[model samples]
Target: MTGNPAPAAAYKGPLPRATPETQPFWDGAKAHKLMLPWCEDCGQAHFYPRALCPHCHSVRLAWRQASGRGKVHTFVINHKAARGFEDKVPYVIAVIELEEGPRMMSNLVMDETPTPENVHVEMPVAVVFDDVTPEVTLPKFRPVR
Candidate 1:
């Protein structure tokens, strides 16, 4: 409702650019799913996709859809927003270790604002999406059952 009529979403204020290597990930988001590149040769998953696998340096990576289950590995609760993300002044940014073993950095959401000591290394989490742009969805997290 920012009267200019650009149809901008509230949560996804400004999104970063996506390259060819990241196209697959964005595509999955459109389906309300999270897809990550897995190294079929080495049996591992990784984020920030690249043509070559980070583990074995294998070029034979494949795109696998994830169940989006994970645990918070570490985090920092930001009381002040950064850059264009000022809308989200107070938030928790965390590194989550997915069930499939990929570690991704994302935001943590819940009823109350988080504090560093309130988060733990192995707190169960699940994926949530913030459809910032029409073509892009940013992955966020919430506590799990």
Candidate 2:
């Protein structure tokens, strides 16, 4: 989980469909960076970018780089793989609490099989990028080395 992830094959699962509001986040991931929408007025950050700030309801939102360090807030092991993910059964779907304070739903890539005995709440993790396609790269999390 701490080392470079095995290069993933072209992503077969649902790819992110970036809209005008979320282009920046997608672009950052393409460049192997983690970016989140930040609200200047509220001095807060948010995910799943939107036109209005969720904190202060301000339109003055901007993209900011994230530290990419967080703890696993919660997680579940998916034994049933959704289409295109059959090759990757028993994956971990986790809610990660970013250091910037926003929680995001993402797949947790680990070197070991994720189990209740190993994947625990509040486990420290860091971001990893998978270039699933030429136009899209996904940000996933892994245990910090």
Model 2 stretches astray by more than 4 angstroms: 1-10
Best by lDDT: 2
Q: For candidate 2, lDDT tens digit of each residue in 1-145?
A: 2354435564578887999999999999999899999998999999878998988899999899999999999999999999889888889999999999999999888778778888888999999987777777889998885
Name the lDDT value of residue 87 in candidate 2.
80
Candidate RMSDs in Å, in order, are: 4.0, 2.2
lDDT of 1 by residue, 28-135 (tens): 876778999999899888887899898899988899889899999988888877876676668888999999888999988776667666677789999988666676
Pairs that clash in candidate 1: none
lDDT of 2: 0.87
